[model samples]
Target: MLKNLAHAHTQKFGKGFNVCNLNNMRAFFLAFSIWNALRSKLSWTHYRSFAG
Candidate 1:
């Protein structure tokens, strides 16, 4: 099912809209969620520096 959905999206959108990008997006969201949950565990400045 997921493969079919990806194929359909690629047919409409062309390249750069593939499984690798989808996985990267998933990882980004997962990281964002983890960051949100830990926002208060450390200083905002520390996080900003680490982000850089």
Candidate 2:
């Protein structure tokens, strides 16, 4: 869950989050950033593994 991760990161890092919340609301809880990340996680990981 991005919410839990973001919460943990916010608590750990303390302010200055680069979270840019967009106004495009689709689902009740789905944010634009999170939706994109979840959609691309698999390919992103694959690309990272190959690159690294």
Candidate 3:
């Protein structure tokens, strides 16, 4: 399912939709499932680091 989703996203968006990236995105979403819990002052890099 991820492979198919990634392929379709790549076909439409043209880049940055590989399996590894999809997995990272899934992990990020799982880690931060609560939108209200996210800190607005933090950058994406900070959030990514936290997710990692």
User: Which stretches in model 1 have alpha-carbon errors above 4 Å?
Assistant: 33-52
Output the number of the lDDT-best candidate: 3
Q: Looking at model 2, report the run of 10 residues with the lowest lDDT sum.
A: 20-29
CA-lDDT, candidates in order: 0.63, 0.43, 0.93
lDDT of 3 by residue, 1-52 (tens): 9999999999999999999999999988999999899989998899799999
Listed per model in order, the count of residue pairs whose N, CA or C atoms clash below 3 Å is: 0, 0, 0
TM-score for each prediction? 0.45, 0.30, 0.81
**Model 1, residue 6: displacement in angstroms?**
1.8
**Which scores greater on TM-score, model 1 or model 3?**
3
lDDT of each residue in 1-52, candidate 1, tens digit only: 5567678889998876677666655555555666546656776456545543
- Model 2 bad stretches (over 4 Å): 18-52
Q: After superposition, how far is residue 31 of candidate 2 from its true place, in Å?
A: 18
Candidate 2 accuracy as lDDT? 0.43
Error of 1 at 20 (Å): 1.7
Report the error of model 2 at residue 28, Å.
24
